[model samples]
Target: MPRHGRLHIPGGCYHVMGRGLERRRIFYADADKQDFLDRLGETLARNGSQCVAWSVMTNHYHLLIRVGDQPLAKLMAPLLGGYAGHYNRRHHRSGYVFQNRYKSILCDADAYLLELVRYIHLNPLRAAMVKNLTDLDRYPWTGHSALMGHRKQDWQSVSEVLGLFARGLGTARRRYREFVVQGLEERDSDELLGGGLVRSYGGWEGLKRLRKEHVYCIGDERILGDSDFVERALAQDTLKVEQATQRIQAGWDLDRLIRRVSQYCGIKEEQLTQKARGNDLSLAKALICLWGSQELKLSLREIAHRLSISQPAASQWVNRGRKFCRELGIEFEVIDS
Candidate 1:
C-alpha cells in the first residue's frame, strides 16, 4: 500500500522516531550520539522548533518536537541527511543509514504532551541502558539529565516541560521527577506510538467499548488524538490542500510569484533572477523560492534554475524565506487583475 503524506501543522507537536538500517547501531560511541544531538540542536534553532524530549538509543532515537511556522521536514531533512553523511564518512562506509523515512505522529499536545515526555525519557531505563531512575537521571543520551538539573542542553525546552508541572522551578522539578518515577511500572503502550482506530481509541478494549456504544469516530495513522481532534486536523489539512490547489488553478506561476514577491520586498523583478545578493534581493529570492515550491508546487530544481542558484541553495532559501515570511506577517495571496 502507498504511504500517506505527513500532516504538516504549523506550531504542532510530534513524536518522531528513526531507526538505523536493519536495526544496526546508529551511534557506535558517545561521540556519534553527541554529533547527532549537535545537529539536532542547530536544526531546531534554525527552524525555530523546540525539542521537548529526546532519547538516543543505540539503534534508534526519539524526539518530541513542537514545530514553528515551517514544516517538520524542513528541520528533519537537513539534520538527518547531515548526520547520515557524517556517519558514513567517519565510519568509512556508505549506503543508506536509516531504515526509511523517519516516522512522525502529530500529537494532541493538550492531551498527551507530558505523558509523551515521560515515555520518551524513560526509554533508556526500559531498555536497560541505565540501571534505574537514578542512573537514568544522569544518563547523557537523553533529555532526562537536563530536566533533572544534572546537565544542560540549551536546545532542550527545559522550562516549557517543567512549567507544565508547577509554577515554581524547584517544585516543578520535584513533581516532574515524581511523575517519571510513577511511570516506571507502566509498560509501553501503542497509544503512545500512535496510529489508526485501535491506537487512537486506546487499544482494542477501548475500541470494543466504543463499538458496543455504537460510537463511530475518525482516526488516521498520521495523528494521535481523540476523534474530534483527528477530524479537526484532517479538516485543516484538507483546507490547506484546497487553498494551494486554488492558487495554482488561478495562474500563480513562478514568474508571477517572483513578480509578486519582488513587489512585496521592494526589489526589481530582474534582481531576484540574478546572482547578486543584498538584503532586499535575498529576501525577494527567498520568498519566490518558498512560494514557488509551496504555492506553485514547483520543484526545488526548477526554483533554483530560475533564481540562478543550486538546488541545495534553493532549499536553504525556502527555510530562510519561511522564517522571514512568518516574522514579517507576510502571506501569499493571488491578486486578481
Candidate 2:
C-alpha cells in the first residue's frame, strides 16, 4: 500500500463536520441526541480536548474543536465509529452511519473566530428549524442558546467564543445574542462552506494578500487555522520522514550491520561467511543489513568491504531483504540500530 500523508493544518483551531450516510437522519429521537452528547462528553474527557462549538442536526453535525495531543482521527475513530455501531445495532441497520469521513478545516482563530461562531450557531436558522432569530434563541438543540446564556452545556467551551466578543460574560452573551439574531436576517459576506483560504482571509482582498505573500498550508477549505500552524505541521511531517531515512542510513554499513546482526541475532560474525546460516537470528541480521543498504543507497563495494564478504554475497543478502520488505511492507530499515 502507498503511504498516506497526514492532513497538515496551520494551528489547533479546526471546524470538523460530517453527515449521516445518504443524508439520513443522524438523530432519530431525543434519546439518540442525548446519547450523542453523552458520547461527546466522554470523548472530551478521554482525549483532553476543548470543544469550542458544535450542533447536532438531524442528518449532520458541526464542530469547532481544539485538537489535543492525539490526532483528531484517534479521538473520532472511537467516538464516531463506536457511536455508529451503537446506532446501527439499535435501529437494526448496518454499514456506514456518517456520510463520509468528517470534514476538518484548520482556521486562523484571530481572523475567522467570530465568523465561525456565528456560522456554527446559526445552523438551525439556516435550516428553517426556527422561524427567525427569536425562535432560534429559544431552540433547544443548537449551541446558540448555550452561547447566549439561555441554556448551558458542560461540554461546550463557551469562554473561547465569549472572550472573542467581549470581556464579561453578560456583555459577551449580549453581543453573541445580537450576532446570531442579526445573522438570521443577513447573508454573510463569504461562503461559510467554500472559499478555503479565501474564507480565512475574510474577503477576496484577504485571500489576495495571503496569495501575494505565497502561503500554502496542507489544509482544506472550511477550515480556519493559522498559516504558521500549517507550516509547522508540514515541517514536523518532513522531520518524521527524514528520521525514518536516517534509520535506514545507519544500518547501511555492511560491516557494522553484520556486527549488529551477530550481536542481536546471536550468530557469531565468523559464521556469516561460511553459509552456516541456519540460525533465525543470523538471517534477521542479514535481512536488516541488506534492507538498510537498499534504503540508504550504500555502494556494493562499501557493503562488501564492511561485511568482509564478496560483493556477490552482500548483493544476495540485500536482494533477499528487498523482496521480504516489499512483501512485509517494512519501511523502517533500522528499528534498534
Candidate 3:
C-alpha cells in the first residue's frame, strides 16, 4: 500500500518508535543496547536536536523528541544510516536495520505533555521489565528516573515534561508512580491510550464525535495513544521537505553555504545548507568539490588539501561531477558560472 502520510512541523514534538521486522529481537546483549544509546547521544548532539524521553527494548525502541528546523529526512539520514551501518558491521549482519520508516507522532505539547510522558515512562513496566512499582521507580532506560530528579542526563530534557507536573519533582514522582501503577493495571482498556480530540479525552463516544467532526491526528488503532498525532506529524514532515527543497531550487540559501559549493551550484554560496538534497544536493556537493579540483585552476593536490579529502578521492569526485549533473538532469556550467 502507498503510505498514508507523515506528520511534521518546525519545532514539532514527536513520539517516535521503531520495531524489528517480524518482532525479532534487535538487541541481544548489553553491547547492543549501549551501542544504540551511544548512537542516540551522538545523533542528537550532531543534529542539534533534543530528546525528551527514550527507552530501548529487545525488539523495539521509543523516543520523544522535538524536531528542529531541519527536515526529518535530512536530520534522520545521518543518524539512522550511520547507526545502521555501525550495527551491521559490528554484528556481522546485513539487510534492514529497522522496521519500515519508524513512527513519529506529532503531539500538542500543552494538552498531551503529561499524559505522553506517563505513557513513555511506563513502557518498561508495561512490558513487565520491573515487575512492581518499586522496581519501576528506578528503571534505568526511561526518562522517568530523570524526571524524579533521581537520575539526570543532560541529553534528556526533563523540563518540558517536568513542567507539566506541579508540586515539584519529588511530589511529581510519587503521583506519577501511582499513575503508572494504575495505568499498568489498566493498559487493557482501549479508552485510556486512545484519546479523543486531544491526548487527554477518552471513550468511544468521544472518538466518535472526533470522527464526526472530521478530526485528523488519530493514532493507529493497534497502537496506544492518539493516532491523530501520528497523522499530523507525518504530514508536516513531508511539507517541510517540500518547502526546504523549493527554497534551495529558488537559489535562496539561508544557511550561508560554503563558497566552493556555491561556485559549484552556480546559484549562490548558500545552497549547500539549504537542507534540500533530493538529487540536486548530492550532485551539488560532488560538483562543487569537483570544480574545486578541475576547472577552477585548482590542482587535484591543492583541491585535496583544501577539502581535506585524499587526492584520488578528490579527483574521483571531480570525474563524477559531469555524470552527477546528467543524472540529476541539471545543466552543467563551468565553475563560478
Candidate 4:
C-alpha cells in the first residue's frame, strides 16, 4: 500500500520514533549519544520546533515535539542525516545507521500530553538501561533527568511539561516525579506507539464505545485522537493543502499577506499590533490569523509572537477569522491547478 502523506499542521503535538537499521545500536557510547543530542538541539532550534519529551535508547529514540513553522520531516532530516554521517566516520562503519523512515503519530495534546511524557521518560527502565526511578533520574540519555532537575538539556521544554502538573515549579516537579513512578507499574503503552482510534484513545475501550454508538471512528495510523478530533484534523489538513495552493497562485507570503489584509481593511500594517476597538481592525487581524494559519501553516504561538499578543488571543482571532470567512463565503481564492 502507498504510505499516507505526512501530517504537518503547525502547533501540532507528535510522538516521533526512529530506530537504527536492523535494530542495531545507534549509540555505541556516551559520546555518540551526546553527539546525537547536540545535533538534535541544533536542528530543533533551527527549525523552530520544541521538544517536550525525548529518550535516546541504544537502538532507537523517541521524541515528543510540537511543530512550529517548519514541518517535522524538515526538522528530522538534517538531525538524522548529520548524526549518521558523524557516527559512520567516527566508528569506521558504513551504510545506513538509521531506519529509512521514522514513525510519527500526530497526537491530541489534551488527551495524551502528560501520558506521553511519562511513557517516553520511562523507556530507560523499560529497556533495562536503568534499574529504578532513582537511576532513571540520573540517566543522561533521557529527558527524565531534565524534568527531575537532575541534568539540564536546555532545549528540552521542562517547564512546559511541568506546567501541566502545577503552577509552581517546585510543586509541579514533585507531582511529576510521583506521576512517573506510577507509570512504571503500568503496562507498556502500545497504543501511544502507533495506530488510530485504538491507539489514540487508549485501546479497545474506545473502539467499543464507537461500536456501541454505531459511530464511525475517523482514524489513521498517523494520527491519535477521538473521532471528532480525527475528523477536525483531517479537515484541517485538507484546508492546509487547499489554502497553500491558493497562496501559491496569489504569490502571497507573510509580508504580502499583511499588506493585502491591511489594504483591504484600509488600516496601516503597523496598526495590526495595536489593541484598537475598530471593527475593520478586528477583521484585518482575523484575516491575518486565518491567512497565517491556513496559508502559511504557522503555529498559534508563532503568530502570537509576531502579533505581540498571547497565544490564546491568537487562537481566538483564528476562530473569529474562520467565522468571518464562513459568513462571507470567502473561501481561499481558488486557482486552476
Q: State the RMSD for candidate 4.
A: 10.8
* Candidate 2: tens digits of C-alpha lDDT, residues 200-275: 3433346657777996423334433333333333444345353335655555455555666566556677665565
Which residue ranges in model 1 land beyond 4 Å of their true spot?
A: 1-3, 197-221, 240-337
lDDT by residue for model 4 (199-250), tens:
3443445766777889755344466654445545665666754445455566
Comparing candidate 2 with candidate 3, which one achieves the higher TM-score?
A: 2
TM-score of each: 0.65, 0.59, 0.55, 0.65
**Clash counts for the predictions, in order:** 0, 13, 18, 0
| TM-score, structure 3 vs. true | 0.55
Lowest lDDT 10-mer window, candidate 2? 223-232
- Score each candidate by Cα lDDT: 0.80, 0.64, 0.58, 0.78
Q: By how many angstroms RMSD does model 2 differ from the true structure?
A: 21.6
Over 4 Å off in model 4, which ranges?
A: 1-4, 197-221, 240-337
Q: TM-score of model 4 relative to the true fold?
A: 0.65
The segments of candidate 3 whose C-alpha lies over 4 angstroms from its true place after superposition are 1-5, 188-337
Candidate 2 vs candidate 4, TM-score winner? 4
Summarize candidate 1's per-residue lDDT along 45-92 as a digit string, tens digits: 999999999999999999999998988999999999999999999999
| Residue runs of model 2 more than 4 Å from their true location after superposition | 1-5, 8-11, 188-191, 195-233, 236-337
Give the per-residue lDDT digits (tens) of candidate 3, residues 1-337: 3344343367766677778778788877778777777777777776667888777788888787777776445556676777778778988999988777776655544334455666777778778887865776666777777776767677788765554333376665566566566666655444434433332223334556776888645443222233333333334445533333443465633222245455555545444545434555556656655434322323445444444544434545554765775666653233223
